[model samples]
Target chain A: MADTIDARIWRGGADGRFETFSVPRRASQTVLDVVTYIQRKLDPTLSYRFACRVGMCGSCAMTVNGKPRWTCRTHVARLEDGPLTVEPLRNLPRIKDLAADMAPFFDKWAKAGGRFVPSTDAEADFAIVEPASAERRAADAGIECIGCAVCYSACDLVSWNPDYLGPAALNRAWTLVNDVRDAGNADRLDAVAGDAGCHACHSQQSCREHCPKSLNPTASIAGLKRATLRAAWKGGP
Target chain B: MKLRARAETLLWGAQRASAAVLAVCVLAHLATILYAVRGGLTAAEILSRTRGSFALAFFYGLFVLAVAVHAPVGLRAILRETFGWRGVPLDLGTAAFAGFLVWFGWRAVAGLFA
Candidate 1:
C-alpha cells in the first residue's frame, strides 16, 4: 500500500473543478476518512457532509471513482489502486464540494406520494400485520431506503427527465403501496404512473446496482407498473 | 392528472402487448426465412410461394401492425428523454411516424403476399 493516497475532490458548485490532495493512507481507512483528513489537515475550507460515520445514514454518499456509493462504508483498500476521484452525486444540483441540493430529490418523493397515509385513526387497535404475508414481504423488500440519493444519482431517467420521481421516491411509494394499513394506494398509483413516473424507467437496473442496501428499486418500479396497469385496466384511480 | 396517467398506462400496456406480438412474429419471420433459404430458393421462388397465400398475408399484416404500434411508443420515449421533446407536438409527431410505419410496412407485406 502506498503511504499517501492521491484523492481528487470536487471543489465548487455547478461549474466546479477537481482539486487533488495527497491524503495519508491508513489501514482500514474509509473514503470519508480521507475527506475528513483533507478538511482538517490539508484544506480547512474543504466542505462535505456525513453523519453517524456509518452506512446506516446515507448522507455520506458520493460519486467515488465514477460510482455512487456510501463513502462511510467504502474502504480505501477495496478501491482500485489509482488516484481516487470523488464528486458530488449526479442528477442533483451541487450545493458545494460534496453536498448536493436534496430539495429536488425529496420533492420528487412528495410528488410520488411517498409519505404514508394512515387508514385508521390513532384510536383504533394495533393492526396486526403478518410478516409472512405477500404484501408484507413485498413491502419489506424496499423499506430500507435512507434517502441518501445514491439510487437517484445512479438513475439515467432522472437525469434525462427532470420531472422524474426517481428510484428512491418510487421505491418508497412501492413500500407504502404494499402497506395494508396505508390508504394512499389509489393516489400513490396515480402519482407514480405517468411518463415521469414508473413508465419513465427503462429498467436499466442502475439503481439496483448502486444501492448500498442492496434493495431492488427496479422490482419495486415493476410492481408499480403492474399496479398502475391494473388500475388503468379497471378504469379506476 | 388522472387522464394523463391512464393514457400513459394504456400506452405502456399497448407497447408491451405489441412487443409480445412482435417477438412471436419476429421468430416466425426468421424461421420462415431460414426454411425458405435452406433449399437455396431465389427471391422470385420465395415470392411465388408467398403470393396468393392468405395466411402469409395475415401473419405479415399482423407483424406490420405490431411494428406500427411498438416503434412509435418507444420512439416517443426516446424523443422525450434524448431530445427533451414532449407535449401535443411530440404526440402528433410519433402518431404520424406510426402511420408512416403502417403504410410502408403494409406495402412491403403486400409485395410479399400479393
Candidate 2:
C-alpha cells in the first residue's frame, strides 16, 4: 500500500475543474475521509456535504471513479489502485465543488407523489394492514431507499429526459401505491405515468446496480408501469 | 395532463404487446426459414410454397402488424430522448411512419399471398 493516495477533486461550480491533492493513505479510510482531509488539511475552501459520516445520511454520495456511491461507505482499499477522481453527482445542477442542487431531485419526488396521504383522519380508527400481504411484501422490497439521489445520478434516462422522476421517486411512489392505509393511489399513479415517468425507463437497471442500500428501484418502476397501464386501460384516473 | 398520461401509458402497453407478438413471430419465422433453406430451395420454389397459402398470409400479416405497431412507438421514444423532439408534430410523424410500415409490409405480404 502506498503511503499517500493521489486524489483529483472537483472544484467550483458547473465550470469547475478537478484539482489534484495527495491525501495520506490510512487503513480502513473511506473516500469521504479523503475529501474531509482535503477540506480540513489541504484546501479549506473546498466544499462538500455530509452528515453522520456513515451510510445512513446518504448526503455524501458522489461520482467516485465514474460511479455514484456513498463516499462515507466506499473504502479506498476496495478500489483498484489509481488516482481517485470525485465529482458532483450527475444529472443534477451543481451547487459547489462536490454538492449538487437537490431541489430538482426532491421536486421530481414530489411530482411522483412520494408523500403519503391518509385514507382516514387521525381521529378515525387505525387501519389494519397485514404485514405479510402481497402488496405489503412488494412495497417492502423497495422501501429501504435513503433518498441519496445516487440512483438518480446513476440513471441514464434522467440525463436524457429532464422531466423524468427517476428511480428513487418512483420507488417511493410504489411503496405508497401498495400502502393499504394510503389513499393517494390515483394521483400518485397519474404523477408517475406518461413519458417522463415510469414509462420512460428503458429497464437499463442502473438504479438497481448502483443503489448502496441494495434496493431495487427498477422493480418498483416496473410495478408503476403495470399500475399505470391498468389505470390507463380503465380510462383516466 | 391526465389525457397525455393515459395516451403515453396506452402507447407503452402497445409497445410491450407488439414486442411479445414480434418475439413469437420472429422465432417462428426464423425457424421456418432455416427449415425451408435446408433443402436448398430457390426463391421461386419458396414463392410457390408461400403463394395462396392462407397460413403464411395470416402469420406474415400478423408479423407486419406487430412490427408496424412496435417500431413507431419505440422510434417516438428515441426521437424524444435522443433528439429532444416531442409534441403533436413528433406524434404525427411517428404515426405516419407506422402507417408507411403497414402499407409497405402488407404490400409484400400481399405479393407473397398472390
lDDT of each: 0.93, 0.93
lDDT of 2 at A143: 83
Candidate 1 reaches a DockQ of 0.65
Candidate 1, A48-166: lDDT as tens digits: 99999978878899999999999999999999889999999999999999988889999999999988999999999999999999999999999999989999999988888899999
lDDT: worst 10-residue window of model 1 chain A: A51-60
Please write out the lDDT profile of model 1 over residues B30-113, one tens digit for every residue.
998887788697888888888999999899899999999999999998988999898999999999999999999999989987
Clashes (backbone N, CA, C under 3 Å), per candidate, total 0, 0
Residue B49's lDDT in candidate 2: 94
Worst 10 residues of 1 chain B by lDDT: B34-43
- Superposed on the true chain A, the predicted chain A of model 1 yields a TM-score of 0.98
RMSD list, candidates in order: 1.7, 1.4
